[model samples]
Target: MTCDYDVVIIGGGIIGSSLAAHLASEKNEKFKIAVINSTGLGMPASEAAAGLLTPFQLNELENPVRKDFCFKSFEYFPEFFETITSGSSAKHIDLGYRQAGSLYLIFSNSEFSQKENETRNLKTIEPRLSFLSKVEIPKYEPLITRDVIGAYHYPSEAYINNPKFLKAIYLYCIENKVEFLNTTVKKLNISSNIVENIVLDNGQVISAGKFVFCNGVWANNFLKEIFNTDKNIIKAIRGEIICVKALHAMPLRKIIFCSNGYMLPRPATNAFETDSVLIGSTSDEVDLDKIQPPLSNTVSGISSLINLFKTLVPDYKDYLVSGCWAGLRPQTKDNLPVIGKIPEIENLYCSLGHYRNGILTGPFSGKILKDLILENSTEYNIEPFQINRLFETQIRGIPKYASI
Candidate 1:
């Protein structure tokens, strides 16, 4: 069947772009697919993210979709990297993927409870997770705070340069002949409960057989009004981070976290290896209009992290920071993303509300969204993150907190 366009995807972030790439890669027939975005991927929270792709969780097994996709995507990065950086001469610009593994430490009561048997079920979460004691700490994480008592490792997950990852998707999409429309979608041109096309900000209309909404944080308002569905699937949260020229040699290998803050290795080239530790972030849930967080808040957030680092690793006491920022993460009420087509709106899908896991689950999120559009079985279950889950209940006026 000759179709005008196979799909019209909204939002060119990691999720949308990845989906476009995956769809084209898996295309058995010709497909005219287009991806639209306001600011594109890695622009806000995704770009400012620590880019730690791990299945490491505090137990109870978070959204199964996210967990499964995280591991799947981790295994998929090497190939994705090769495909995207095949011709780029610039070394650092090439997909910055490093399988440094992740080190998850357990501290405090609630934190301990959640992480207690997590390592035991490490195989379920991540096959490579192993317990580490004080003695083994130095061998693994030499620069980490000496106060670290309990920890585990997940070697499968890789730390990514998120911006490059997004760029790679852009390259992959362009390479695959996926069209990009750099505009915000005003509304779904829906009639009789079917999304026929999308109205752009400038009144230009584009048609599609399948419509996927991958815009984070901004999806809620769109959903409520477009479908008249009051499902609160996205929670806007602000995260503050500081790029301290890794300030210290830093015993941390993959990702390090204490009570106050967590840090990840920066990807972009910097003056010093120790100078590029991406220290973050204050997880403050706020309204969409209040998306931009305060710089003072970012500074204080870094300071708090420094204080905690001092207690854990005294070497980071007088470190100098290079950059500081705050970004928004689109969390959901259930702390899981919504990643399937809305039953109410046929051919209209959603892969949003990923919050901090956009980098971790970005690739797989794209993979699954592709499967849904192509009518193939997804690699993992999609029920957990169904967009309609929250709307099942009448959630009234109480504010909620963000979950990591």
Candidate 2:
């Protein structure tokens, strides 16, 4: 059926932005596109992301789908970042781009054994990661506290200023021309297993040739109605972080992670001569609106960081507290993201259900989604994330709802 646009993407989070940006760049003068989101999709989760871009694979044995996607996305950032900044106006300088490296600090033997095996297997597929001995830790981060232990350092791991990156994508996409629909999508109108129209909370109805339900935790609700879920595909996972500005100018050389928490240093500002540090975070599952940090909880979420920092970097105690906040991550039961078309919906597709590692997997997701929509062969396989798995999860006793 003819429609106003070639594609109408739901959810304006990072995945939606990246996809729109990529389509704008690739489509050039071709297909028209639009991005839609909920009343508050830009709040919390996407805005508060730690924005870590490490390439280290996790829980491969338990969820190879995310492991595969993480590696695929990590490999795309270098060129992806290039594509993003290619035609930006000369007035703006590149913001907080860190190609320095990242350390997955290890203390316990269990973490060591698990990471070591994953690193070894990853080495065969990607020669990008290497294990760092305890002695090497001090050399990489000279300011590292004396209590530091052995860590796995990914030298090519890069990072960006979260706010700046978000703004850049918005600007670049607009320049290249991607329509953003800022309204709450009430429901999806479907018939014969195809998305026909989107009914927005604002009383507007829009139709398109294809629909991508990349609505993070909200995906399960609609997927349950559209396609029954069986396995734990997408769950709303909560996390928190604290930002501290140090009295002394001692900032971290690389992103610091311990079994307890992590400390990421922001680029220096006049207000922050040395720089600000992001020490976070705690992982839990809860609804966003129901979850607000009580004053008592402020000191609670940070307790882990305080203890871990003392062990990873003794000097952590010397820093002054700047600010603190909380965020939610769309965690999947299998800890992987769903890509490609939905089995039940003929022309409907999704790229959501990415858990904690969404930041690490954002880039490759865009390319794959665009390629899939156009029916092009992708560099990596996406069969592991099919929405059909959600049907299995529903059979196993998971609650289902409609698009929120």
Top candidate (TM-score): 2
* Model 2 per-residue lDDT tens digits across residues 1-404: 67877888888777877888888888864688888876554353566777777656254565655665677787787777777777554126555778867788777688888778777876776576777788887888876765535888777777766656766777777787788877778888887666788888878888888888777776766765654433335777767777777777567889876656677777664343457777777876775445444312246677776665566666766788776666667876566678887665667888886666666666679888988887645767777776555555435322232232
For model 1, what is the error of residue 205's alpha carbon versus the real structure, in angstroms, after optimal superposition? Answer: 1.9
For candidate 1, write residues 88-193 as lDDT tens digits: 3323463556788777766555766667655566676555567778678778777776565667667765677787678777876777788887888887766666
- Superposing all C-alpha atoms, what RMSD in Å does each candidate have to the true structure? 5.7, 4.1
Which ranges of candidate 2 are over 4 A from the true structure?
39-44, 57-62, 106-118, 122-136, 228-233, 269-274, 288-299, 376-379, 393-404
Q: Tell me the deviation in Å of residue 169 in model 2.
A: 1.3
Give the clash count for each candidate.
11, 13
lDDT of candidate 2 at residue 126, scale 0 to 100 = 51
Runs off by more than 4 Å, candidate 1: 1-4, 28-30, 40-42, 61-66, 76-79, 86-93, 106-116, 123-128, 229-231, 246-252, 267-275, 290-300, 376-379, 393-404
Error of 2 at 219 (Å): 2.0
